[model samples]
Target: MTSDIFAEWLKRQGHLVFKTKSSYWYSQAARTFQAFPYHRVIEPDNNEINEFLKEHNGVALRYSTPLSAKYGKISYHVLFTQSTYSIEGLPKKARHDVRNGFKKAGVEPISFERLAVEGWELRLDTLIRQGRVRAETQSAWVKQCRSAQDLPGFETWGALVEGKLVAALIAFSGDDCCSILYQQSATDYLRFGINNVLTLAFTNEVLKRSDVSQIFYGLHSLDAPDSVDEYKFRMRYTASPVRQRVVFNPRLSPLFNPLTYSALNAVHKLLPGNPTFAKAEGMLRFSLQGKKPLAEQDWPLGLLEQKESILKQY
Candidate 1:
């Protein structure tokens, strides 16, 4: 549940781990350092950032920050922070689907090893459905699932239909929060509302624990479609406003200025479905947008209630 355990899990899988004054970070694609415990909202001061960058040389650091942060892009985190959760608390449509999903599938915790062997096809179907088959190959997926087999704080839950795994999710429980890392379902069973059932099941289980205060679904994607988070919203999760900052080293920071962002923004259009260009454009756009005054920044529309408590920290 501690940051140390999370870092150890990633380290065992050969990911480079960095411990900072506030959080644990891991090097991911394109030499970017992603802060983890994914629920934790960290606001790294300039001194901490400079120290880390000096040690790492060239790398980008991305993490969720408070909405009142002076620097960083406005972003949203998908989270369920209700004091209590139940099927009755869900909306009419979600309530109906969750009930049906339960009738059609049995939801329970499964061994990570079992998930590794039986969850491959589920992962493939999910990637294909999301048009992101390039995200992970079969071998890579197998290794990822198997790597968490004996890791503490990590649990795998699955929804089974007549003994066949139809949907599954991997969640990490921290001292006061539980983060859902991955969820995949059989596309053919979408009509059965299996994924809804799985989300509801795990979310409820986490909430039942007196020590847990929230269930973090994940951060809103910078490159993907809005429909991705829309589904979570429909499942009764709210869009928790936060600033997502992308920090580059001193030497490389200039390359991501307004000129470069505009050029890449235009380039991504001609490139069609290029994820790299798409993400770069997003990062630059956020950085630029974050610099504006608070009122000038666009809010999450209806996704967030702009109350003083949620908008301003003070």
Candidate 2:
């Protein structure tokens, strides 16, 4: 039988095998979807995985943490970035506070307003310059931003340096909390501590008045794990577990509830360093080494890349 035919036969026999290359397959000998979650597959390294995940703030954060079988831990993170309680009396006063902070440091707070389109565009460029993202992936990100903008509760804000964009953030406001999706700042401005200023401004303006009780920093993985977490932590934010589960059934599951529960139990019996325990580790490697630009042919749907080129370069 041809390799395809043989592989099909194995699949039919309830053996779990995955494609390694164009035509080759290998087996872990499992049958249920709840048995293997593709997202949990360890391929690349942890750094790269974290970088790739930075673009999709939630997903990266979701899988970056240590996994547990407890139903409450399925989601790895959550925040008040999505609350819609109407930050009434705080943000209006941000300009004054930012200015005060700047003045205290013998600097001026350069103000700027960034629409979603411009914000994403600038973010793509920032990623490329930093080498966290390749040019092609930035293009795909632009398209994603356009779609995400129309969704309810999406917002972004930033501070400027001498009329040049220095720091910015993207977030979602919901009924109770806000989910900070992405944030960036120019390297040169790091010494100025613009990130702290930006966070304080965002909280005072948006979170404080929006009636939003908390700010969710998304996920805390090995890569830049503490970068955002540290900032939010100082702002009186506390970590809360948002649980997630990966399930594998040969067939796509319409409902993953029961099987997900089973998979969690099975995973718990396993220890750290088991093949699955290294998903983020493998993904991190892929993101770091696979610094290749996205092919144009994969536009609008290509996965994001993660690398340390820019950090290394500087």
Candidate 3:
């Protein structure tokens, strides 16, 4: 797959993205650059990172490096290895959910246009459930999905109950990696097990491809609760190990040290509710913690289990 398609998709969403020797870095949260594809562990030379920062007016650049590489916080890629994926292989409780979901909803590939028009409600429900309604607006969500329309390598899948969309996800098929992005399901349908059915069916479908070898659930989230990805783990995705690096502009590096992170974390805890504040605190915390050796850093929960499955393959 042409990786540029993902970058193009992001650009169409009105975000600025730049390319370096190692990967495509996109502007996020009004001032930060985040590397995409989620699975790429890059080795960017310091000079290049410095040059990019200089050119971008010193916006922070965040990317992942191998655990053995220098400077980053301990985090996981949260992935599923491509193998014989089946509901029969899922844990007992999850297997039950998938079975029930299949009985209740129809899983199928839908056009991005349909997602743009009908996905708004599911998106809203999801954000509301997560108390992240401020993270995205309905118009923005529709525009984002609509922009991916007809984009190659981007696929839309949904679990429909009585022909109404209850759960949906947008999967980008990168060469050797299928990244699942923007997954949301209606809260009421949790009983119907729509998320289980959609995740299982979509994941199985992607793994069937001979070229794709892994499915990325997402990065260890910077702000959301761990339980968000815990669901994916329940559905059989491994929290694959990686070091998420936050490369700050030299001029601003002083503001991101341990003391600053500690103070920010304390303030955010008391403030609560605002996503910008929460993420700002999380990012600073990651930047500070990542500078230490892995032995000294606190690892994200479950990051080691089945991690070798990806370290060996990717």
* lDDT winner: 3
Model 1 off-target regions past 4 Å?
A: 301-314
| Global lDDT of model 3 | 0.84
Residue 251, candidate 2: C-alpha displacement in angstroms: 6.9
- Candidate 2 C-alpha lDDT tens digits along 250-271: 1332333445434543553464
Question: CA lDDT of each candidate?
Answer: 0.80, 0.42, 0.84
Compute each candidate's TM-score over C-alphas. 0.91, 0.45, 0.93
Candidate 3 lDDT over residue span 1-314, tens digit each? 36789889989998888888888888888478888766888989899999999998755888888877878887888788857788878899999999989899999999898999889889888888776777788888888888898798888999999989999999888778888888998889999889999998888788678989888889887888777888898998887678888888898887778788778888888877677888888788788888786667766776755454544553
Worst 10 residues of 2 by lDDT: 297-306
Q: Which should have the higher lDDT, number 1 or number 2?
A: 1
- Name the TM-score of candidate 1: 0.91
Q: Highest TM-score: which candidate? A: 3
Please provide, for model 1 over 1-314, each residue's C-alpha lDDT reduced to its tens digit, 9 standing for 90 to 100.
37778788788777899888988889876777788877778888988987887787646778889877887766788888887778888889888889989889999999888888889899989877775566666776677777777877889999999999999998888868888888998999988889889998888788779988888888877666676677798888988777887888777887778888878989988874666777677766766777776567655542446545555652
Error of 3 at 170 (Å): 0.3
Can you tell me which runs of candidate 2 are displaced by over 4 Å?
1-101, 104-136, 148-151, 222-225, 250-314
CA lDDT, candidate 2, residue 22: 19
Against the hidden true structure, what lDDT does model 2 obtain?
0.42
Best-to-worst lDDT order: 3, 1, 2
